[model samples]
Target: MALFRWGHSWDAFHDLEREVDRLLQSVNLSLSFQGLRFGRQYPPVNLYELPTEYLITAELPGVKSEELELTIANGVLSMTGRHISPEGAAEERFRRQERPRGVWQRSISLPDRVKSDNLSAEFVNGILKIHLPKADEVKPRQIPVAFGT
Candidate 1:
């Protein structure tokens, strides 16, 4: 009976460990200090790869295009900008502030080298979509298979 109890406890501990790992993977590793998430970037992003190009979509609800800066260097694409708060809210008291404000920079690594010159970006409906064309050498190709007798 004791051996069985120990085995159940060990399994429970492993399950808890896996749950913690999953939660950590989904959230940004940021330290909360003084009611502020320091060194944390707002607006989560999603990246997808199509047949010809790679698409990166980021959620930027209140950020304007004029305040955004996009750059790609060393195979990493970076988007940096500041979220403008209300013009005059210094004296206002907030009940619960969930939306992140202030300057943020998010960098994503690319799987392959892309054509930077032909890259296109569009911001519409609070979503920023960037289309990066894969280089010719990196694009997949199908070679004709010659079956010899």
Candidate 2:
């Protein structure tokens, strides 16, 4: 009888170990999937700046010009937009989706004083362009210096 009892206890321990192993495997799989999703969600953006103006361009294929909103406040420029997926496209079937969709916002600090009222934005093809003109005081000017001997 003692031998039979030991055999039953051993089976119970083995079953418990298998359950724990399965739970651990599921957790690891979930973490891996999350990491992959995050990597494909956010891509890099390019910004350009000149001596008198600031220019920003973003790749937004299939996004309409009217969908984007640009604003400047307190020396910061913010760009917000949404990219609608193509019609009849199945989102779940995509093998790789690097382009970000939904409402996205990017804010950058102005390199110089900018005339927010005169800012302009245009979208052509797949590029979204922004033009920010510098304020009068921030523009470079030549000043004559006199030396008194």
Scored by lDDT, the top model is 1
Q: lDDT of each model, Cα atoms only?
A: 0.75, 0.67
- Highest TM-score: give the candidate number: 1
- Lowest summed lDDT across 10 adjacent residues in model 2 is found at 34-43
Which runs of model 1 end up more than 4 angstroms from their true locations?
1-18, 21-41, 91-93, 141-149
What clash pairs does model 2 have? none
Q: Please provide, for model 1 over 40-121, each residue's C-alpha lDDT reduced to its tens digit, 9 standing for 90 to 100.
A: 3455677799999999999888878899999998889888999887776763566655667788888888889999888889
Model 2, span 1-149: residue lDDT tens: 01112245478676665565556555554333322232232223456887767887777777787887778899997777787877787979888765556787777777778889989888789787888887898776799999999
Q: How accurate is candidate 2 locally (lDDT)?
A: 0.67
Count backbone clashes in candidate 1.
0
Name the lDDT of candidate 1. 0.75
The TM-score obtained by model 2 is 0.60
* CA shift of 27, model 1, Å: 14
Give the lowest summed-lDDT range of ten residues in model 1.
1-10
